[model samples]
Target: MNKGFYFERNLLALSRFDPALCSRLSGAETTRGRYRFIESRSGESIPALVDNSGAAHPLHSLVDPRREGKRLISTLGNEGFLIIFGLGGGFHIEAALEKTTIEGITVIDFDIHGVAELLSSREYIGIFNDPRFRLLVDPSAEALEQYILDRYKPVICGGISLLPLRTRADFSQGLFNQAGEAIKSAIDMVSADYSVQAYFGKRWFSNIIRNIAQAEQNTVPLAPVHSVAICAAGPSLDAQIPLLAERKNRPFIIAADTALPALISAGLTPDAVVSIDCQHISYYHFMAGLPEQTLLFLDLASPPLVASRSPRPYFFSGGHPLTRYISRYWRPIPEVDTSGANVTYAALSLAEYLCARNIELYGADFSYPRGTSYARGTYIRSLFENKQNRCIPLEALHSAFLYRTPLFKQGDENNSWYYETKPMAMYRLRLEEKVRSMKARIVVVPGMGAPIRLETNTGDNRTADTLRLFSSGKAAMGALEFLAQYRAGINALPLLQGPVYSFLTGLSKEETIIFTTLLPAAAALKRSAPELDTPELFDAVKKYCVGELEKLLGIWGMR
Candidate 1:
């Protein structure tokens, strides 16, 4: 608003603060060596100091003492003003005046009365006379920040809010948070400046986190599991605990979070804990006091807050693409496709892969007919009302991704929704449908001898108690191991197998053949490029194969 002070830096941009405004308010009071404050009838008083002195202050090099003494000159910097809640003796003002090219500095304190006392001291005289600084001497955090916003709103708009809060009880512990948000919003509305980010010291640290699937899948040899059980904390697990305990030595035990506390109370410790929840709020039911050290099958993209607290955190990912990071870096486990499965489905997927033949579905009830499991750590008594829409309309999609009528959108309202479905009747109908489709021998051992008939394929599935837990006297490797063999076999005869490989990995049949044929000789490639050793070569091969296929297909031609 002054001749030199522009609201912006350039003609089109706001000057840092307002160089012209600093010069216009010079009609205060000053001397060549010592400055003094002259109180106007309108009750305006400011210390006169130097501006553009070409000399820095002895005590404070930022502002210099000026010959005229009405304004202290300083430069616009990462920090613009020194906010004194109580302007004491004008020492803050004099200290600030020993600089150059400053737009202005606002001082708020309760000691305007101290101005008279400061003028008597020659030490504070020269810097206090500068008009570039306005000393209000007000005393309120709200008032201080608000006044700063009102007067220097242009400069106060955006920056990392740094508040060294000093209080008796620290009630203002969250003040920086409240003020930072307001300032950021004001800055966005005012002008384009630095992109400001708000950080609260109380960002919240939890030794216990709710639900976030942090899975890290890699090509690790599958752990030997002669007999395997995917344990859930369902009421039915209570009925089967006796049987499970009797033969616990024979099987590898994996328990879902909820089942751990109870199962452990029964003198059972699981080898691993499987968590597959995107919802974090109600995850406490499973993880309230979980141990710090345990094998965790966690989602890779789960909130860092969840795994940060874990003693030894390994990751697994279910649906997130970023999950591969866990596999590439840390030891990982597979993220089983759990679209249509409940606890039983997840349990079975683990069991079958572990080579357990007599896989029994324990308490795989999809409905919460009663209000609760009649036990501790029950997550939900019934499904939320909105969840009805999930079952209401269903449409199938090709590939592993399912298109449920209402998708479980991230940050959606249903993330933590834990209400049960309509009733036992609806769940029974769907269960029958799924069981009939799965080509396996199934038996639903009813609790209390209730006749819960599960109609499976009308034939006996092979029952083999002899499970090969090792491959050639080594730890058994499952699907991932076979993938390498399949790839190498195709590479040896690309043209013949190209189409089939393409179709399998979602590429066209022709592309499959090309990819197969072009698969570079592994040992030869490594020898040609020293960097392409065992581990690196496999990934390189996968990458080159995918890239060639993608390029041939073109962006538009991709599936």
Candidate 2:
């Protein structure tokens, strides 16, 4: 068979999966500088790259490339996603696709001309035809990162493994290294997000559904302010109260839920309070009673009991998929960044959303100073005090809270020390990262906890004098009516007639939106019942969600 026939077949197969890449390859100029085809001992064609010194480096073993491919792929353990850094001959990718456990495979390589040459040399239609396989040729670091972030669903794809074709990667070492870094960064973000979803998926759904009624009535928009002060519940908050109180009326104070009680105890009322936790324990922060005049900025997934604390709470959409769907379809709620996974970070996001020019952060200590878990008057301290007995003193309770996770003792240049758990350290790092991109000027008040290093200079203090907190779009219908429509949409979805991936990919735009709203619930269900297969899980989630929606509709009618 002519090589041209092989190229045409491969191009046709490639077009089915990635038309953009196929078009690029079709127009790409053939380059013959590095790679040359040679016959292996098995009488199969193999690619070898020639260096400047005239040394030829074969991508695979000259004896048996098929065996070598199997050996290389066998080293990876049960990872669902395979990120191959270099694509040389497609043998390893074929081997990867053979494993049922591998859900997806992405091949990243530099130089479109090189990839075009490979396609012309031999047939790769077998690999290209596989639905799970994709080729990203000559992608920039940002493009690769965004692709992984969008395509690699860790929930469906259990784990990720990166396989590098050593010889091919060595040829473009710098580019490959950048690709590796991008992949690692994307994986870290996806893994963190997936873990959160697995744990709070059901809770978030329940909370959002329960709060729909409140969200409909509480449509009062908050007016943006100029200067804002955010109060966290770190131990440093105890001493920072006086400073916060001095400028209480001067700058608008936005207190984190944990810091709300402490601020009120010091006779300082915040202009607004932000809460993001989906757990029921979040209501403890409001046990101290929310000030009637102060506005409440609650995440759509916040406990409904927390929403009830305020006469008309201001609901904002956090990073939940269902909340985002609601914002798009049900109503357009203001989106607040809660990706940092901590209330302090969410508070900063709320400040930015309010269009503040100069933002001052008080009690934003991201660690426990002197083994103090929280400032005086915070809910944790009071809860512990109430539970303490003869055997378990308040001090012991505090110590237990501080030592719940592995602690890393850290100190600043001023010799002040604090203890940080892994989660706290991550939260602080995430906040610092967020600060670098923020438009508002961030000023962290000095404290005894771990120092927050702000690398960027304060941003220009030119923000709008006032902005509306919520979008102009109102809910299309009442809460019960919306739930009825949503439940109907879920029911209208086609039954699973094929594989899970095919069924998902075949969904229309509106269907996709409806399906996406159920992902968190599906994640939660999967965690509780790991034995359920993908199709079974989808059916179960659909049934469970529809039933819940029905229950909500019934309750609304009774009321």
Per-prediction TM-score, please?
A: 0.34, 0.91
Q: Model 2 segments beyond 4 Å from truth?
A: 1-27, 40-44, 61-76, 140-142, 412-415, 463-469, 495-499
Q: Write the per-residue lDDT of candidate 2 for residues 1-559, one digit (tens) a residue.
A: 7756777788899998689888888887556656788889997788887788887788888888988999999999987888998888888888888887787889999988777778877888889877788899988888998999888876666678899999999899999999999998888888888878889888888889999988888455656778998999998999998987776357888999999998888898888899999998989988889988888989989999899998788888996878888888888888999989999999998888888888998998888887788989999998998999999998999888877789988876356878888898899999998988877888999998888989675575664345555442577888887878888999998876543455666888889888878887888888899887666887888999888888888877831
lDDT (CA) for every model shown?
Answer: 0.39, 0.84
Task: Kindly list the per-residue Cα lDDT of model 1 for residues 266-326, writing each as its tens digit.
Answer: 6666666665544464255444455544465554434455564555554444432223322
Model 2 residue 470 lDDT score: 49
Number of the top-ranking candidate, with TM-score as the measure: 2
For candidate 2, give the lDDT of residue 475: 79
